[model samples]
Target: MKMEFDLRMTQEQKLIMTQQMQMSVKILQMTNMEMQSYITKEIEENPILETEKKSKEKKDDIDYKELIKYLDDDFNYSNKNYYVNNEEEVSPFTFISAKKSLKEYLIEQVIDLNLSESLKYLCMYIVEDIDSRGYLYTNKNILAEELNVEISTVEEALKVIHSLDPPGIGGVNLIECLKIQLNKKQITDKEIYLIVENYLQSMADNKYAVIAKELNISIQEAQRYGDIIKTLEPKPSRGFYTGEETNYISPEAHIKKINDEYFVIMNNDEIPKLNINKTYKNIIYNDEDEKTVKYVKDKINSALFLIKSINQRESTIFRILTKLVEVQRDYFDMGEKYLKPLTLKELAEMLQIHESTVSRAIRDKYVYTDKGTIKIKDLFITGIAQNNYDDNVSTLIIKKEIKNIVESEDSKKPYSDQKICDLLKEKNFNISRRTVAKYREELEIKSSSKRKRY
Candidate 1:
């Protein structure tokens, strides 16, 4: 048992810090809204870094909303505002929308209230904890413990805070909020309270008979109360304070229909116009203090890196989208049904880039079009079995078929998960029973036993 120690580099290697990898992972995980805030913060913190905003920006240029509308299945189809606004009215055009935040509104009300500084601070903390639904998610006990104050003081602060505008704003949950609203409106119906507090779960599950039995009321009565609950605002934060805006990806390509041809315009117009900070460059040239020069150099290098990274991200997105448009041209020209089959590997090989790069470019990314916005990721698909008829099928098409089958099945004799698998296999899908069940669950459909009417 002899120990020989020999250190030799089999290959030149560099050790990467965990923090650097963590930062990259964090950036990758950030939603478009969160990324915007991050970039804005970076701009503020880094002196040399700046955003480039283009002049004469077109209203429909970015096409983020358009892309989302396309991707979201539940988007209102009948909303005329969703389509291009065709009205030709000469109304005064406001350059900027003056929207006030929920936090700011609360602070304004707090100013009129003669509360001490400490109480105000506590109220601010409470207000911050209130989610978009206007429900206070944090417990009063926790707040009291954290502040080293009695629970009574926290309750008192909550009482004052709840009285602010937007009634039922500071409740800990939906039931409490509704109770507050009901009390304020002077509705002394015990049935309403029961429905709000206890029967909500039953109503959600559409178990009318169970709710009626539990409450010792008629099914019709239970349904009426359920209707009332439906009318209540679940999300109290709708159009409230912006608080922390999520980082959103602005679209890089705008696809437009011109005559018979589709036009693809890169929407890189909105990115903040960036340049090297002249002041920093001057400091570097003037032999400023060694530390100052180093600091300026670091800032300049950071700005360059950021600018380069942004450009690369844009280019990667553009290349992926360009290829997507080429492949799915029929979809852009005609409709969704005409969408062609594409894969990350196919794009990666064609573009001479990694499949991961293609995946990242499409991850939470979208493209704006005359029809609407389409998520970049939806362009790829795993094809289903093709029969002797030569009709190509995609997984999306298979999922749609499964949905139709379930939807049209008899309620008394709903198709079992096994039956679905059999039916799909008969149609040459070559899918397993487990796969069918998985797809069914993803569609939020109930099992045959659960879906049975009798």
Candidate 2:
């Protein structure tokens, strides 16, 4: 037997991702605000692109009849108008005064107290060290080393911070924060203070009987003190801004019902229309130098690709939403209860596109429906098997059912996880007791014992 090396030639077909293709994918995944920022940056960098301006004369000559006809043809909906202004008017005072941060508020209170220059400086340092949750976790020794002072001095500064206007602003932990608030309020109940300091875990677990026995009190008394402790603020800086502004979500599409038929509408109007600059186009056509011509050609190609990518993104999103509405028509007619289980793979197969393409199309995108603004991805949910129903139900539907059951339960004797599981089974959801507990925890619902009231 002999071994010989054999060589053979074979042709293979492979797809390589081009730079423009990558750009298109990136643009497809960007949210509305992100796409706006990206386009603005591109326009500033490239001299061959400009945003198209709408003329007042053209706007004035708009025909309502033709517009309605076009919409009817595209969406197969009636010409009934449903647009209404739902935005509430904001108070002028809201814009007049900027929000005061937790740090600034603390600093202002510190200024009102008379202190030595060194102490005031130390107080400022402590104030700055407090986290967004209004808790100071920095070690006194480390702070003293940084400020070139004794550990006792840092401790003194912390004490001063603990006395600030927000009762629990400078506490080191949840227990300490509660103690600080209790002390500030002059709460003289020794049992309440001791429970907060020692048996907070037992209290959270609803071991009220054990706590009462340990403290030589009745379970009712323990529950009454626990209720008082619940009134304390866990997050002292909740109302204060942390140098971050609220982000407003803009829906990328809309689903409207007209005469019992649902229609999908893409929000192309929010995006600015872009076109190649006439001057740059003329320069590219008239150029003779190879280097200058190449530069202009590259920029022009980039601008063209960006514009095409924007249009393609919108078209792809519209197609995906159209397919979604077709499949989930029951969801649109009824509510989330009727939402069917869907997956990117299934939708991609229906559209004859890659699963990743479907993912990119729905990334950070939202849709406005009769149910209000909802993330596009939220529409796709995994299905769970049901004993009674022919088809599987969505996990979201199960969660909604669990939430409803908990909401309607008696507060004095809340349903246990096992009881909840039995109730869901009666409703056709054959789920286990453990799964019910897991879903309950995910919904932030406490255990039956913890939810019990005296």
Please provide, for model 1 over 320-375, each residue's C-alpha lDDT reduced to its tens digit, 9 standing for 90 to 100. Answer: 66677788888777776676667789889999998877776667766667665667
Looking at model 1, residue 396 earns an lDDT score of 73
The global Cα lDDT (0 to 1) of model 2 is 0.80
**What's the TM-score of every candidate structure?**
0.65, 0.68
Candidate 2 lDDT, 177-236, residue by residue in tens = 999999888999999999998999998898899999999999999999999898999888
| Candidate 1 wrongly placed segments (more than 4 Å) | 1-36, 50-131, 136-172, 178-195, 202-212, 215-233, 239-252, 283-295, 389-392, 449-454
Pairs of residues clashing in candidate 2: none
Report lDDT per candidate: 0.68, 0.80
* Model 2 spans > 4 angstroms off: 1-7, 13-15, 40-130, 136-167, 170-173, 180-186, 199-220, 244-248, 254-279, 404-419, 446-454
